[model samples]
Target: MTTARIYQRPKNAMQSGRARTDNWVLEFAPSEAKKADPLTGWAGSGDTRDQVRIGFPTQEAAVAYAEREGLAFTLFPAPERKLKLQAYADNFR
Candidate 1:
């Protein structure tokens, strides 16, 4: 049986203003190990499913998709990050 991981999208500081973090993502764990390329020093796999990521508006939707696909899923809890709101002037203080 294949296992899938369902989790909430993380808030990225690089994409803070323009990014959407409300959605959840469903990702399938790679069934096979990746092979390393000696010459290029890169590792890759032919499994296209490894790169498949489906974004859902809610965690429930992500869970539903995993069930529909018959994939045993592990639900990763959403991480709570506390962000302190501060002004630019605070940095100078």
Candidate 2:
């Protein structure tokens, strides 16, 4: 199974609530290995294909980027898989 985590930049990291002019960033952490090679030696060292950072002009833009990149949107403490579950749970709910 593959798991992904998403995080948004805090307000203090931005400038005056302006995302375009400020630094609005998002990070995605992969919770699984990329390949099943036992001795390939491709783990950790920031090259494990398990981490990525993206910047945008606004929160909405960052969110759009996350969606486009197929990441789970958590938005700080609501829930880890809230967005992911909500996306599919609507059919059953």
User: RMSD for each model, in Å, please?
Assistant: 2.4, 14.3
lDDT of 1 at 59: 90
* Candidate achieving the largest TM-score: 1
Per-model CA lDDT versus the true structure: 0.87, 0.54
Give the per-residue lDDT digits (tens) of candidate 2, residues 1-93.
Answer: 333443444444445563343445666555544554567865444345445566666667777776776766666432132234456668887
Clashes of 1: 0
Worst 10 residues of 2 by lDDT: 76-85
Measured with C-alpha atoms, the lDDT of residue 52 in candidate 2 is 58
Q: How accurate is candidate 1 locally (lDDT)?
A: 0.87
TM-score of each: 0.79, 0.40
lDDT of 1 by residue, 1-93 (tens): 988899887778776562657888889999889999889989998877899888998999998888998999999988887889999999888
